[model samples]
Target: MSIPTLRMTEDLLVAILLGDSTIQKKSAKHELKFYLPPNKQKILKMYIEKYKLQSLICIEGVNVETDFFIVSNSLVLERIIREWSDGTSVIFLDPRLLKNSTYMLWLCLFGRKVNNQVIIKQNTLTLDTKHTLIYFFEKTMRTSFLRLNAEGHLKVQAIDELLLASIIDNRPSYESLALHELLTDHSKKSFLQKQEKMKEEMREYACF
Candidate 1:
């Protein structure tokens, strides 16, 4: 079988690198590996089909193990690493390359909704990478919606969820859409009200 040409993109490369995917090199060849639980096989399949990477993909331990992995015989990931990563495996992605919102949407996959906010766990990222992401988000959304939580993860509160959903090209998952709607309808107003109330309380405290 002939090797397929991978339809690689900067956004997709960054997205995968932000996820559970890793790059490995052997005998002058570089490959990308994605490890997922059995339940997440559909994600791997979707990526393979989306990128026209079917011929280059190899699946391992799908049926016999609780976890499985997919390997893509491509050098694209290595090229990205060379450009983006420091020698210590910490990525310092160039802010100029983050022009597409699709990657931000992809990053949301690693997030979980909490009390009308989406908290994206990015503990693995270097501080530089985190700052770059924050800069990119603010520049693209034209708002200061993204911030780092106390745990150093990326967070977007309810007030900005609608803006985020609107900017991304791909449709969000049903759960995310539902949450966005609920937050947009209720949380935005209440969040503002709370902020005002807090200011009033501080004024009262100052007077006392």
Candidate 2:
């Protein structure tokens, strides 16, 4: 799969990072264009919504140029960093420079600082650590689900393993061969099933 080429200005990113710019709740209508691998998409959405990311955008993919504030976190932090690793020009904000809303998210999403530095996984430099956690967590969750389903103890219906694998493996960023090597059919199905059930439970118990 081909790496996505992001076309944007560095100065704007710097402005946002430096707290020199302001973001409104709504900006001019812009189409957000991002094509992540399939498996990564759900993970990305989870991070975005969990972080209330739209609060940080001055303009989001509307005109030829748009500004955004990205709140990097566990599942999608590595992906965001990977996008910036190719000299794509990412601006990192000093923790103090962030707005109240941004600061709240950083604290809630990333946790408190240890010593003076906060341990965050943003780019490829930290991808190994972040991906390792994601991989192991997903793998463990998948195993738990498969064990339950196999024992005829499913909370709902189950789908074919191959189909689930296809959903997780067919994203544009990761090559099919790579995905195939990374995730077995059974593992992918179990992972997807667990993810689906988790979402259903969250919605069922969501407040307001």
Candidate 3:
């Protein structure tokens, strides 16, 4: 199947990828919902339906896990499943991480790739789809810590870019990282620093 023209604009796409939104914490219920700008949310709703991804969630709870190709678009699924029938799968991560920008920042600090398991990040999770560190960061942010304001608008657009840029600096390499990083490299220092911190956190997560 030929790839359809992705109608999502670059700016909106970035917001969606980053999960940009204002957050609200409800102590009583302990619930969260990431919101996009009104226009953007409408756009996303349409895309989700068009892509038939409304029910595509694979991983459950805080950590998500699922077959890669199942959630991918026809174009990507066809390409990835060709070589490996089983292909690779990814973890969606916990929603809480969205609120934990520090942790989110740390995860994207490195371009991580280990054998067949290509772990990067994106706003929406797709099977067999290699995720960019920035994309991954945005996913965690929206799923975990972000939401739309009462008026149904985004609160921090500029801040999102700054945060995204800072997170990019945290990632060292993208070539061996995710397919998305095949050619983009602007933030080497921050990426390296964030990488070290992540290693420590990984040890902690593993300890429990």
Candidate with the greatest lDDT versus the true structure: 1
- Which residue segments of model 3 deviate by more than 4 Å? 1-17, 21-32, 57-208
Candidate 1: residue 51 lDDT (0-100): 62
Off by over 4 Å in 2: 1-55, 62-123, 131-208
TM-score comparison, 1 vs 2, better candidate: 1
Q: Sort by TM-score, best first: what order?
A: 1, 2, 3
For model 2, how does the per-residue alpha-carbon lDDT over 46-132 read when each residue is reduced to its tens digit? 544543443433333333233232322222233433343332323332322222233222222222122322222232223333333
> Worst lDDT window (10 residues) for model 3?
63-72
Model 2 residue 42 lDDT? 43
Alpha carbon lDDT of each predicted model: 0.54, 0.31, 0.31
Q: How many backbone clashes can be found in candidate 3?
A: 22
TM-score of each: 0.58, 0.20, 0.20
Residues 128-186, model 1: lDDT tens digits: 77787777767775633578888777776554444344434355353244334435436
